[model samples]
Target: MSIVERMKNLSEKECPVDILRKEIAGSKCSDCGKCVFGYEGVTQLQMMLGDITEKKGKGTDLALMKELCALMKTQSLCEDGEDVADAVSYALAHHAQEFEAHVAKKGCAAGVCKKFMTYHILAENCTGCGDCLDACEEDAIAGKKRFIHVIDQKECIQCGACMDACDEDAIVRAGAVKPRCPKKPVPCKRK
Candidate 1:
């Protein structure tokens, strides 16, 4: 489905800004540079969207994007550019609050953006098998054998390798609200 369609049928897990950013990155509309409106407009959109997803968006970004999309809709040389412009316009018109949240440094409600997500090791599920510690290249996981591992949020890069390597399903990604976990490694309750 098109990005607009997906936005129209958005689920609780999907963020409109992130969805548009992914669509722009994956689409080839910006590959053609025959027209400045089509090429530079899409390029700017990509950069702006990237910044927004990374939590670096400015308060003025929405206004700037709207103006660019307007120009692309009318002046683009091809349908591809026009379609992308329409998708962005649709999202801006319908999901402006989502854009504002990211721009204002508020957490993503959908939790799809990596910059807004935090990885946590669930103490209840952790078996202290040491697999997660080995999988972590950042050394974010701290624990020894038979003890519940604790994740250092400052040191963590939010990579899912720890989650994948964990056979006990101890690691989880949290958004908005983080779970209560020990500040340091503790004895494992699960045997």
Candidate 2:
């Protein structure tokens, strides 16, 4: 399942009554991340979980995750975490480009990670139906009716609602690059 789908299911089943909600420690997480012999894998998982729970804006630490996966592949005690470690290793070995994109460009080729996605409107494809404007909660999309819309890269939260709303297939991905919009071309300077 996608992260958005998982989050939606959790929100629906776990949080039914919002009027009065109390702390419920359902699962016993011993906080002992000893499945992997090294602390790197579990530590990064904990950090990622914390960020997800807190709704942190930052993307995950890809370099750290990669290192942790490598460590866990050899150091893990049992099969519990070894499977994931092996999967990570497989991905690193075969899908290095995908990981590199996530780390270097902050973009997911699978389009599963929202934090690394930036929605862009294609002028040629966009019918300018104003669907994206209504879908965007961050007010990042701006354009007049019958005109091509533009996504304000800085203001976009990467929720992907705009992409979902567009029927003309105009909304596109630009691989969310922070501190610098990928839509703008940067001049290269030779050293």
lDDT agreement of model 1 with the native = 0.88
Best by TM-score: 1
Task: Give the per-residue lDDT of model 1 (tens digit) for 1-191.
Answer: 66566667877778999989988877667687898998899899999999999989998999999999999999998887888899999999998888999999887888899888889999999988999999999998899998999998899888788999998888889988989998999999998
Candidate 2 structure quality by residue, lDDT tens digits, 1-191 = 32222222333223211100111111111244565443445555455434433234144454565577667667776553554445444434554554455445445544445566567776657666789999999988877667667788799987889999998887777643322223432222211
Off by over 4 Å in 2: 1-43, 46-77, 110-112, 125-127, 174-191
Clashes of 2: 0
Question: How close is each model in CA RMSD to the real structure?
Answer: 2.1, 12.4
Error of 1 at 12 (Å): 3.5
Q: Give the TM-scores of the predictions, in the order they appear.
A: 0.88, 0.50
